[model samples]
Target: MNAFRTTRWSLIAAARDSPSRAQAALDQLCQAYRPPVLAFIRHSGYGNDAEDLTQAFFLRFIERGWYAEADPQRGSFRALMLTALRRFLSDQYERAGALKRGGRTVESGSLLEVIASDGQSPEDAFMRAWMGTVLEHAMQRLEEEWSSAGKLDQFRQLAPLLLERAEGDELRAIAVANGLRTNTLAVQTHRMRQRLRQLVRLELLQTVGSPEALERELAELRGALDEMT
Candidate 1:
């Protein structure tokens, strides 16, 4: 059921419904992928123009109603989005200089900021931005879950264990501060990791069109993580 709950279909349905109801899902999809798309544009050598192009690209993609007719069966949403982005860039490149990019700009130091300036490959920059945004999505959800449960501080204490390597001394100190034994802290961190894993999968599920596709994406995600290390 989660497979079809993908934003690909949601945006499609929203488009078919009415313009007013369509923006929410469309906005969500655009916002989730914006960082990577912007990174791609940045690495393509647009520099200061990437931010403007990012907004313009999204506005074109949605306002043009391209996604409403997009066939998710033809390809993954990731592939489709990238393809759309490339097309947007190609069409806009010649006009970029003439387009006047003085509109809204990206804030200070986003994931895509200075990606191209850092001597990173376009593919690497895009992947870094993609993974970063996905992790941000999952972290935000976990934070919300903990906040809703009134365990935000506990989650904060354990979050580092899941997302980053916490030193043994630090973990033990956290345990002592939280009134938990070392073993109890270990168990809680394990549970929190499990929850984080589930949330990550949930985020991935939204990007896939089917259960089989989701499984394939999950396998690719693991491979990507492995390669990152």
Candidate 2:
């Protein structure tokens, strides 16, 4: 199958044609991106209302069929989601009084309306949270792979180095504790890191439309992680 057809955004784009598949895609999307959404909402100062706002955002995104407007040629799935979220937040801000009074009001608006861009973008805290979620999901997959291969303990032992956070002394101690030579531990760490990169790439690929977009998203992910550290 063509790569684009397998993307979550592609399933979302098929909302009008395949409601069941599109519904499944929406479920997966909400599950994976909920953390980022909550982070963004809280960072935007929603605080205690973040959970409600996040739920409302996804509800509108699904019931309103906003995903159908996603344009692959414009950017990656992350960008598409962020744009919609910005619009939704802007709409909410316009109705702050109702929201502050503990009332939920999601107004209908055309996705085509030009949302003014400012320094506060989805690329701010949202991008950082999204990248963290991506890395976490990739690591979870790596852990699953290692567990299935009966190397779960090894993976857990060497993961600090794989994440580039292990000190040489710490790694050496772990190697000695595991009854392995430091050189063998080093080799295992290198292989695990390479496998992790591959898993991260696969995770990004499923949400991106093209190779170029994948590269761009990967670069952004790296930059976001750097900012977080």
In order of appearance, the predictions have TM-scores of 0.82, 0.81
Tell me how far candidate 2 lies from the true structure as C-alpha RMSD in angstroms. Answer: 6.0
Q: After superposition, how far is residue 22 of candidate 2 from its true place, in Å?
A: 4.7
The lDDT values for all models are: 0.74, 0.76
Encode model 1's per-residue lDDT on 145-170: one tens digit a residue.
99999999888878878977678899
* Candidate whose TM-score is highest: 1
- lDDT of model 2 at position 214: 86
- At residue 218, candidate 1 shows an lDDT of 73
